[model samples]
Target: MARVARTCLRSILKIVNSTLGLVGIAMILYGFWMLRVLQRDMESPSFDDFDSTALWFIYTFLSIGVALCLITCLGHISADSSNGICLSCYMVIIFLLLLLETLVAADILLNSDWEKDLPEDPTGRFHDFREFVESNFDFFKWIAMFIILVQGFSILLAMTLRALGPNNGSNYDIDEEYTSATLPLINPHSQTPPYVVGEPRFSIKNDAWNANK
Candidate 1:
């Protein structure tokens, strides 16, 4: 039953890791799309103000996406090879990512008083910012939340599988010491003697004959 549970956990981990890999790819694609959209927006004649903050945000997303994809590959390789070290590293990476995601989510949720601080031009960039805070920001937060949940579950499954240890049976190699130790010892002196016929012989010296001589 324990072995069965381990097997099931391993299978689940594999699926989760594969799904994470796809998520990573999706993140990278989304980052690229965001960059393209930003570039298009920046090329507009009336869009003279270069928002360095927005540019940094896009770059951050791109970097995170790349990191996710790389970590996902590491996870897959570790799982395939059953490498404890690699799995450990992968777990650490996922944990850090989870932490960062949580922080970002919290920051967005906590400092969401942008409406009161809106600039005079409420119909321009300020409006867009408010719209994002209301809609797109929430969307990003939810995505981060999903990623965190998946990563946490993956870590749990990975740890469980690692704890189960290898499934192979006993070693197949011959053990010479054990073989010799188990063998019966032979003692030649312990054998029974052959049956002998009944015979009695006696020898005596006569001292009187020597005296006569």
Candidate 2:
């Protein structure tokens, strides 16, 4: 029954790791798409005064995408090898990433006063931007929340698979032999008999008898 559970856990780990790998690939592609958009925006004369902070934010996303791809590869390798060390590291990183994503999603969901800070513009660009963000807020929040949950699930699966191990327990025969070899030998013959402290010796008078004969 335990063996069956381990097998099922391993299968689940493999499937989850593969799915995460695909997600990493998708992130990479999305990052590239964002980069292309950023480039096009930068080439436009109207975007010459684009905020440097926004550009840095785009770079941060790209870095995160690349990091996800690398960690996904680690997870796949760990699953295939049943390497506890790699799985542990993967879990820790995923946990941290999950936390960060959750925080970002929470901030997005809870902060509703940003519109008040927007400067009144005659061009209506800020208004359109605000509308676009408002329209997509729920979608972004839900997606982030979903990803966070998946990451948490992955962490749990990794821990389970790691605990299952790779069937590397010591062989019974080998352990028996090792135990036998390490024991000290005892010799019963080497023990000394108890000695008497003082005892009178008696000798038979065989000589006197022979003289008499």
Candidate 3:
């Protein structure tokens, strides 16, 4: 049971963590890359009027990257150590993150005038970000969907890992969890009370003869 559970849950968790790490690194790199674009555009004079508000997007990207890196680290620690404290903290953070993203995603998809709910952007950086999303709707949409799936999977894995508790150094241990446990016989009156364990192994000659009779 432990081996099977690990094969399904722990292995999937590893994949999710790796995916998160890659996404995080990509975001971090993309943030830097955007900064480069900003610098170049500013220098090119064609974008001299670049709204400083664009910094908002850059900062948000970097912030998300940092957050994801933190999550990935927490996930790794929780999965490897299976410490109660670590797992607890990881679950709380992941759940909060999922909630936040869910809310934002819901707003974006459900609200027709989502932009109106946003604060007025004097620097127009928000407008630019909105425009970017609108222009690359398909790509961003898929990425967001993927992220949601990954987060959901992570939550399930955490719960399952918690239920399973720390591995006892062997997968078969789970299957034998109750092997030595005292079990009551179904026919308690017919069998002796101490017959909780399986009946003593013995020749069944008497039973065979009885069956023949």
Index of the highest-lDDT prediction? 3
Off by over 4 Å in 1: 1-7, 49-54, 112-133, 136-145, 167-213
Error of 2 at 212 (Å): 80
Q: Regarding TM-score, does 1 or 3 come out ahead?
A: 3
Error of 1 at 63 (Å): 1.3
Q: How do the residues 39-87 of candidate 1 rate in per-residue lDDT, one tens digit apiece? A: 7776888667744664654565577667777887787776665567877
Minimum summed lDDT over a 10-residue window in model 1 is located at 117-126
Positional deviation of residue 3's Cα in model 3 after best superposition, in angstroms = 5.1
Q: Each candidate: how many clashes?
A: 0, 0, 0
| Residue pairs with backbone atoms closer than 3 Å in model 1 (clashes) | none
Off by over 4 Å in 3: 1-4, 45-54, 116-129, 169-213
Local distance difference test values of all predictions, in order: 0.67, 0.68, 0.77
Candidate 3: tens digits of C-alpha lDDT, residues 65-127:
988998998898888876667777888888898899889878977998987775554444456
Candidate 2 has a TM-score of 0.60
lDDT of 2 by residue, 52-137 (tens): 55454445546776787787788777777778888899899988887777676567568877445434443333455458667998
Rank order (by lDDT, best first): 3, 2, 1
